[model samples]
Target: MLRGFYGAGAGMITQQRHSEMLNNNLANAQTPGYKGDNASIRSFPEMLMQAENVGAAPGGRNELIGSMNTGTYMQERTPNFAQGDTRQTENNTDMAIVQGDVPVNEEGNSGALFFNVANEDGDLRYTRNGSFAVDGEGFLTTAQGNYVLDDAGDEIFVNNEEFTVDAGGNVFDDDGEELATIDISFAAAPEDLVKEGDGLLAVPEDEDALPTAIGDDDINYDINQGFVEESNVDLMRTMSDMMESMRIFEANQTVLQAYDQSMERAVNDVGRLQ
Candidate 1:
């Protein structure tokens, strides 16, 4: 009975964490570039049930109850780590990086740059959100007034009020002429970038993969004028997971209750009779 109590307690704790991750995903269903988190469990080693009479000498073959039951522990935090679906929002400020690989400088993890999902400022902010807009100066800017960098490793200056992005992700002027390109490539490496909040990436100054390292001709990233990438969380899958977790929790609870009653009867009635 006592063993069952301990098992159930552990099981409850695991269930709580599972529910928490599920709730978080549901809350971010509408969030762009949102990633889901998942929970896992570990098991306790099997052992024989404690004998009723402590220190009693072994007389008969031990009935193996220990081999039948299992105790568990909550495992490490493993993210669901699946790519969200791509959504298309035809807003001039919206953008998405179709390329799966993000490059950074020599800083393995910390050097990553973060981008503003909403592109509040064209200036470099960390975010996975590719949505962006232009500033009053006609310069490619985020909502926050930060300048968007071009392929030349310089700020994409829009001296002309009219700007357009072509098939090759190049920005063109009013006469349908090519003005500049949004160059987001690296010279040394992209592996050094780390993931900051809002789906942006960042790198350190010491990192060699600076804009100067890459040549002008090397700038080859395509930028869409009026499109945005949508969030990728699958609703059906999340609901299914919720149901499964509920059933498992209920089953564990029933087992715990039965074990309690069995022990209660054995102690209250059997002990009294003796």
Candidate 2:
């Protein structure tokens, strides 16, 4: 009976975590370059339930009764790295990187690529959000003012001129002079990248794992100038998931309450009978 209470409580806790993850996904559905996380639940090992005092009736052997489950826990929250839709802003400063061979509209090519940026502390990060601007020092920077990196892993500085980014991520001035190629990079397994907030991803510190630069003849993707990648979250699916999680949470709560009541009755009513 006590084990039942613990099991039900564990279930409630797992459902609560699931609900939180679903809510977070819903909240980020409209965020650009946002990825959704999937929650996984794992159950503790089951215990063998043996019949007590049944040894004398079963050839002096302990009688097998059944198995009882212990409890469950939230195992992991894995991020999904699926591509999102691209929106054309025609603003020249915005950009989007498309994946796979499918072109985004009729103007975009496809490959796995992301722009490199540095935080205020100069810690490197990667992002698909290309909404960039030139700062006071004429350095290309993200919306948060983080300097955008170039192919050489250095901050890109350009004069205030009408600039254009080509399909290969090369930047050019109004006079058609090439300035710098935007630092486009890729991880063999993008899912391995750790998610930092604000649509940025930090490369793992593992010495064996490092992001590679996008080289010529490599998988080509259009750096769609004047465009931004939207969040990949499916709104309808997320709404359905939220509703289902709520139902599961309620069910778990009911189970937990029932377990509590059973425990109460066992303590009060059964104790009084004894």
Candidate 3:
């Protein structure tokens, strides 16, 4: 009876976490370059049940019953790196990365591309958000004021908003003078990148910054100016998944209530033994 309570309670907690993830996806549906997360649920190891305080079997071994499951929980959450549709904003600073065929990692997962930026402490970070702006100091920066990095791992100084970025990520001023080339980083396993808030992805502390995606003949990609990539979240699917998760939560709640009632009967009627 106690095991039943534990199982039902675990199920409810798992579904609650799943629902929260789906809700987060819905909230970021309109965010540019946002990737939705998928939940992975796994069951605990099954335990072998044996008769207790009973006589030994033919060979002096306890009688074996059946296997019983403990419960389930959410194991991990992985982000989906599928590219989203690009929308033309007609703004020169806006850029969009259109990824093509790329080398797959040993895990059989395709690699991904991202724009390199420097955080407040000048630490390297990655992001797909292309809504850039030229700061007062003639340096290109993200919405959060992070410096946009060039191919040489230096900050890109465009001097003005009237600059053009070519397919090769070369930044050319209005007078046609090449200033710098935008840096595009490649992640063989993008899921390993940690998602920091404010549209930035950070490399693990123990890992080095990702390598540039340029000069790789096998890697094909294009940077489009005056455009931004939309979030890849599917609102309809997220809503449906949220509903299903809620239903499972309620089901578990009902099961837990049943267990509570059974326990009450055992304590009041069975234990009374009038």
Candidate 4:
């Protein structure tokens, strides 16, 4: 009976965590370049039960019973990296990257690249949010004012000369003079990247997080200058998941209540007879 109570409690805790993850995904459904996360649950190991003594055919002997499942727990929250839909902003500063040869929309091309930006502490990070603007210093920077890095890993500085960025990521002035090339870097292993807050991905400080080179045939390297990527979360799916989690949570609560009542009866009502 005690084991049953523990199992129910574990279930309630796991369900609470799952609900939290679903809520987070729902809240970020409209966030640009936002990725959804899912909670993974793992069951506790089952314990083998054995009878102290049992009767075999015409003989008394010890026998093995079955196994009993203990409970489940939240293992980890895994982020989904599937590509999101793109929206055309018609803003010259907005940009988006194409994951592969199959474009996300008509404007997309083949490429697996991300824009590199620096934080206030000068620590480099990567992002797919291409909503950029020119700062007072005539430097291309993110909305948070982080300087965008170029191919040389330097801050890209541009004057208010009506600049344009091409699919090849080259910047040009109003006079058609090539000013600077925008940096589009590829991650050799994107799975190793970890999500920091504010739509940024951070590589471990100890690992070499430099962009890996790819041949022209391998990637289209196309950059759309007037678009932004939307969050990959599916609202309908998230709603359904949320409902399911709530139901499971209520079930666990019911089990816990039943166990509590059983214990109460055993202690108060049954103990009175003694």
What lDDT would each prediction earn against the true structure?
A: 0.58, 0.78, 0.93, 0.80
Off by over 4 Å in 3: 52-61
Q: For model 2, name the residue pairs that clash.
A: none
Order of candidate numbers by lDDT, starting with the best: 3, 4, 2, 1
Model 4 residue runs over 4 Å out of place are 55-60, 101-112, 213-216
For model 4 the local lDDT of residue 128 reads 77
- Could you give candidate 4's per-residue lDDT for residues 157-223 as a string of tens digits? 8874468888777888888888777776676555457888777888877987656333446656567
What total of clashing residue pairs does each candidate reach? 45, 0, 0, 1
lDDT of 2 by residue, 1-274 (tens): 7787788788878878888888988888877777788888899999998865555465565668898998889998877767889998898878888765422323242324678899888988888777788888888988889999988888987776669989878999888898999877766566667887887888678645245556645455677888888888888887887788778778877887888887788789877898
The digit string of per-residue lDDT tens for model 3 on 93-182 reads: 999999999999999989999999999999999999999998999999998999999999999998775999998899999899999999
**Candidate 1: regions farther than 4 A off:** 45-70, 80-83, 100-126, 134-162, 166-223, 260-274
Q: Which numbered prediction scores highest in lDDT against the true structure?
A: 3
TM-score of each: 0.61, 0.88, 0.94, 0.88
Give me the displacement of residue 262 in model 1, in angstroms.
4.6
